[model samples]
Target: MEYKHVVNRIMLMIALFISIFLNLQAQSISDSSTILIQRNLRYADAPLEIGQDTSSDRLLDLYLPHTKPMQSLPILVFIHGGGFSGGDKGAKGNVALCKEIAAKGYAVVSINYYLYLKQNKIQGASAGANMKDGLPKDGKFHTGLETAVKMASADTELALQWIKNHAENYALDTNRLAISGGSAGAMTALYTTYRSKQKILPIRCVVNFWGGLASTDDIRASAPPLLTFHGEQDDLINVAYAYALHKKMKELNIQQSEIHILKNMGHAIYNYITKNEINTIDKFLTSNMPAYE
Candidate 1:
């Protein structure tokens, strides 16, 4: 009958509406997603060899697009934070970040550096008994921090150099190398971006999440348009450090810097919150970052 036909048409229209709504939601989610890449390439060892030992740290984990025939992806090298004493590439929180960023289609590399405190002596054995003498006497632990940063930075730069020398192998767009990190990893990221001297092309952008600014002079000397985030309630690496650093950069006419202080947040807020801040950071990295070669 005519009435039955009308009812069937109405049902079809409703189903179509629901399908359209679901498709839109899926698209929105994809707008904020990340991907991962898994592979290792042979790289020159000298760039990573800062000491007498000329060994290559070619190990890296990349998170990028999930499509067939991999596209040329932007590179993001992320470091972890364990006070330079202990930390691993497989750490849960950092791995989550790597996966998240990779889902967004950018290549992310989470790396492990040479840790300073092993058995306890200064540069002690990798696995051995406790050596209390290895511990710094004063509250200051600069030696361990310095060694870790140096190793991490060297590895990062070497990775970049390798990417440059073999760009076609990794399918990475060499022009868009960006560095980011949290805590001590933040120190390594910021230092590598602004403090160290490497032969590769300058890093295009830098992001610091809940990290401190060591010294302003070096940062200013090679400042590459910084984008930093910190939690206002972060007691671990006081928010003031970020604020003061921003102020100094502004004073120095470094106009392309930005800082976001999350209200009522604490250290490592990115790990606690939903991926909203992550999306913002991705936009900042991809869209708002300053122009650099």
Candidate 2:
């Protein structure tokens, strides 16, 4: 009986120690004064009367780190992918990813842009043709895609402009701005930063997840540091696109650019990126953006 009683006491003590350790860990996490997330911020309003019609897809969600070192934080603006057709700023998976990035001591914004559906009859007609025949019969297929990409790029630029206009309000360091996106959104991010006429912010880095530029020519000697993630088996947007971009980056002596290819992975690499991959991205961003360090 005495031996059993001693065993019970030891078990009780172990349980108590575990409980205390868990409480301490929880407290440590809660006490860390970092990571503030704000959702549904209207960075820009639609129908800006900029020579054409627009939609209400100009909203964005922000993730911020509260522990500001110099009262300024590096910013990452993310655009969602839907092939210029469909997608939302508040995607659950992306929001979770942005929050994780924010926890790593950076400001993150996921934005929405004008879709191809918002364009005039030309876009509608081209889209209809694309739906029937995987490719549009109208020689205007490329033109329509270009127009859609340009519109989304324009909206992305407007979002950046909005951020620049409200930098102090958001505690953002415009000098360390970066852009990221998936697929079409990734294309928009690259296009907007590389092709836009209005150079609002000095982009520090780019995170391209299975994305390609509308024009490879946009890549110049002055292009910012780039980190690309693509799947080797991506059928929708061939892995070749990423390889081509990396080749150009190398040719241009953009030593800071890198492409990570996931073996046997497909177009949905974004959905399957592991925690370790995210950590790698965090490390890349921190290494490139000194403010995060």
Residues 66-155, model 1: lDDT tens digits = 663344777787877765566656677877777777776677777655444421346532211111122223423355556656676777
Model 2 lDDT at residue 289: 78
lDDT by residue (tens digit), candidate 2, 1-293: 99999999999999999999999999888656556777677767765533342223677888887665566878889888867766676777677677778877778888877787444436343322332222223423367767887888888888888899888887788988889988787877777766776577788888988877534676789888889998887777667668877888899998988899989887745556645577888888877777533
Lowest summed-lDDT stretch of 10 residues in model 1?
126-135
- Cα error, candidate 2, residue 171 (Å): 1.7
List all candidate RMSDs to the true structure.
7.1, 4.8
Task: Please report the candidate that would top TM-score against the real structure.
Answer: 2
